[model samples]
Target: MIYNTLSGRIEEFKPLEEGVVKLYTCGPTVYDYAHIGNFRSYVAEDLLKRFLKFLGYRVIHVMNITDVDDKTIAGARAEGISLKGFTAKYEKAFFEDIETLRLDKADYYPKATEHVEDMIKIIQGLLEKGYAYEKEGSIYFRISSFPEYGKLSKIKKEELKAGIRIDADEYEKEDVRDFALWKAKKPGEPSWPAPFGEGRPGWHIECSAMSMKYLGPTIDIHARGVDNIFPHHENEIAQSEAYTGKQFVRYWFHVQHLIVNGEKMSKSKGNFYTLRDLLSMGFSPRAIRYLLLTTHYRKVLNFTFDALYQATASLKRITDFLFELETRNFSDGQTEEARNMIEKTKKDFTAALLDDLNISGAIAAIFEMIHWGNKAMEGEKLKKKDAEQIKLLFYDLDRVLAILPEKIIEELPDEIMELIKKREEARKNRDFATADAIRDELFKKGIILEDTKEGTRWKIIKT
Candidate 1:
């Protein structure tokens, strides 16, 4: 089950096509570097994709790169470059950022500039269907024509003050809320030859055009940030259904914002931190990904330096468990109790995720297994088969979590290994000061050691 923003409730997920899920996510406007708050939605969308695949569904995901919005136009103008050249630089950086955070690439990354023809076609259909009108060379979707205008966001026309709002991209519209389907060509701005008479596509119409061109008229799921629930998504529904005369989307997955220190993250607030900023602060990509994904998508993620440090520690625990399972010497036999615990953990993990993609609950189940495994390790030694089962379970869980390190890290340098050995000997010889010094030196070299009852195991901490 997953929460549907349109329905305002959690509904059982049933794809229109059997065993296939068509997901459309709103991508970023490539005007500047994407901040951590922006990635909170992207990471949640990635989790949604991975979880669906885990449930044996073939997903066709499409994300749009908004390269021609008002912000992008201004950014290009400010840089004294062509609109294409300006957006291209940020587009390249955006993809690199996604890769750095381990997000899965969408099947199609449709750009607004490339789909102007599709937007023109949809606008023409709306004009003919009497759902839209032209005013001063700009086409606008007449909100009064669509009686169910506020259904998705539960905003009522009566509550809206009668006024004129002319924002082509991101703003609230009331008093019939007629939004632009196509903007009139402006001086020194990128414009395309269209039936709408040499104008650019509006922000709301870009998704409708690109989504319909690739995913078809009706998409199975549409995921975005909660801020889009108003003018943006609301207008999308009005214009899309007006053009296609069918439901625009089945499920709407909206993620909440990422907060910094109990306030909404904003540059003006002096709380904005981009991925590069976090990385420069010595936070690992894995730890940042873990921090971004650990909370439920619907809840506000409160990000802090302390929270990031804790996430680093938590990820270390999981990595330590993996290392222990990899190197332990055990005989080939399975304890029935251990087997039962493993099976139960897998079931609980699946059940939790099935319940509205409850990832936090699923993580709890993993920790339960980890706790049991630690206790069992202290008693009767785990057989080789039992160790493999635990490892396999972790691999299965990591498929959806994706927070685990993907590779077995290479061995530390011989000097670093010797230092670790020296630290172990120092502790054995009751020389606490020497042991502490060796540990600090290794820490500076990006190696962290945990003293388990089995022995001293070290993990390479990515700075």
Candidate 2:
């Protein structure tokens, strides 16, 4: 069951029609590299899509890139590049980093620059309905015209005036609560011809226009970071619903911030780090994903190097166990006791994932299954069919874990293979000390060598 933040309740997720989900996620501004805090939202959304696919739903996901914004203009000016060149550079990097993190690609990645006409049409509609007005050369949405302006944020309309911050010279409006729909063309800045004038769309309006252009006036879900709840998403709700005279989104999902060392990560404070930066520091991509899944999506995740180390160790153990299981030759079938244990494990794991995507509980269930599988494998007189059933159980649980399956078959370098051979020879000669020394050498190189009843196996230790 999916939880809808708009209603503040959990409901059986029935699509607008049957068998399709229309989802939208707020994408990056493309001014710089996205830090880890930004990825928490992407990871949360990826998990949502994965779970939905596991439950047999076809999803059409759309995310927009804010290529033309205040930040993009300022960054382009600093780098002496055109706005097009600046946004393109960062957008490419964003895709590469997300691929490294193993995030599923969106069905459509719309850019703000490509949808200027759609945004102009929406603004024109608002102006015709007296919900928007032009001040000087810019267009602003009149907040007072929309009676349910604060419904999504639950902020009272009377208290919203003081929360708005507008420049006095920009306009002499009656209310300080108005937000911009379009900014008039400025000198040496990117602009295009529109019905209103020569200018560009505002940050908030771009999302509503792009989403509605691709997914219609209403969608199944709209997701963003929690920091966007107050002004950005609230403005989107106000503008879209007022223009279409219908609901904006059915479910509103937001992910909490990722804190580092008890404080929020910020670029000005020099505490910000990107996914590439973490990888250069020897953190594995799997370890990063593992650390992200340890906390719930709605809760703040406090990340530290120590926590990453623990994740690395935990992943290594699971990988080692799976590697051992795959090498054993076995046939298909199961004893009564082994079949019951596998069924119980599968039931527990599915139940945990069904309840609001409880990933932590699901991980605990995986470890329990691993424990039982190991014990079953250790029996002296195990049936071939029973051994195959145990291996299949691990594979089934991995559909959600996404950590163990990748580690089952490892690629070893020639040097590592030579060391393993040397260690094996020493062990056969009864030279225990020399064999232990060779094992330590492999550990120093981030390779773990394991000895099982089947044979010798090795895997890359996530550091």
Candidate 3:
């Protein structure tokens, strides 16, 4: 259950205030559709929240949308649309993608554009504290003032570069190391009026301002992709700690990047795959989520068609087993072996998740449960009540796994329903030949029929 913090590894966790967890996750800068790589971070965050709830902690998760950033401004201009319109389009897409992934909804979804006043007030505080200075037409955080600038990323101060701005602007600051707090007014760019001037907030400043505004100066956890460790998160730490003079976050959890062919997935690489792309290719969203959970959150997940196919097959096996268990009968009394196995699996799964959300290990524990359940069923050693108990145990495990239970009773059209009823009646009358002919007729129409202890089930087979 140890968590690695930027300061050091912590073996124990004590909430800042009992029973309350304030979590801040760096959300997408909505300019375009989010790729699968982006979804990986969201999935990791979702799991963290779920695990926290499992541990009896009340979590207040807040994810801020960078509705106005350099990228958003550029995108709006390029598309000849208003900043509001551009951000709305991409934000909707991001929400839809994550919703399909079944990631838990954040308690608060704050947008940067809506928090300009907060950003301005924070910048004002930094200015009053001498941690920030106004440059030509912009406000920049004086990196030298914050002695611990490189602490979060562990980058040495001597090796740091100046003016490493992500924006494509011609205005260069006198010091390249000084990052922006506020960008001076520019034509064709979104702006808000403040004491400094009419300008927009910087990329890194938005999160610090919005997070602290909602979740106090210090939060329980702050999470983002590992790529944001430098510059983005580093700057956030510097600005937030400087303004508040307190710890910004107790635990900083970062999920590793999703790679394709050993290269990071990015828009610049032109090799990124969006969730929509996978869906269009006939991959189920559940299978995509399964593929993600199979790998540890901190490990680099290398995605490929083969990996996805394997995940699909594994998910199908679990679903089929659950379907069978639904119809089987078992006695109420628990077997010692089964009880011990369940307790061990739960312990291992919790330990893995607690250790920086080691999802791969937790998934392996789930497979062990599946194996035990399968064996118990095959030997008929499990009474009807015992089998029911196993099924209930799996449902508890699936709270974090988020996989839906398999449907035992397949849906049928009115015509197909009538055919199945006729076939069943014929079988009851001992007319085997007629029943066989009807089954063959249904099979020709892309339906595969199966009879279980409960009743008959049919599946539509896609060609």
Scanning candidate 3 in windows of ten residues, the lowest lDDT window is 162-171
lDDT of each: 0.88, 0.83, 0.84
lDDT of candidate 3 over 308-417, digit per residue (tens): 98888888777777766775666556677787787888898888888777787888887888888889877877666666666777778777888653454467889989
- Model 1 TM-score? 0.93
lDDT against true structure, model 1: 0.88
Top candidate by lDDT: 1
Candidate 1 versus truth, CA RMSD in Å, comes to 2.7
Predicted candidate 2 versus true structure: per-residue lDDT over 79-111, tens digit per residue: 999999999999999999888777778999999
Between candidates 1 and 2, the lDDT winner: 1
Q: List candidate 1 segments past 4 Å from native.
A: 162-176, 418-437, 449-456
Candidate 2 vs candidate 3: the lDDT winner is 3
Ranking by TM-score: 2, 1, 3
Q: lDDT (0-100) at residue 366 of candidate 2?
A: 72
State in Å the error of residue 438, model 3: 7.5
lDDT of model 1 at position 304: 94
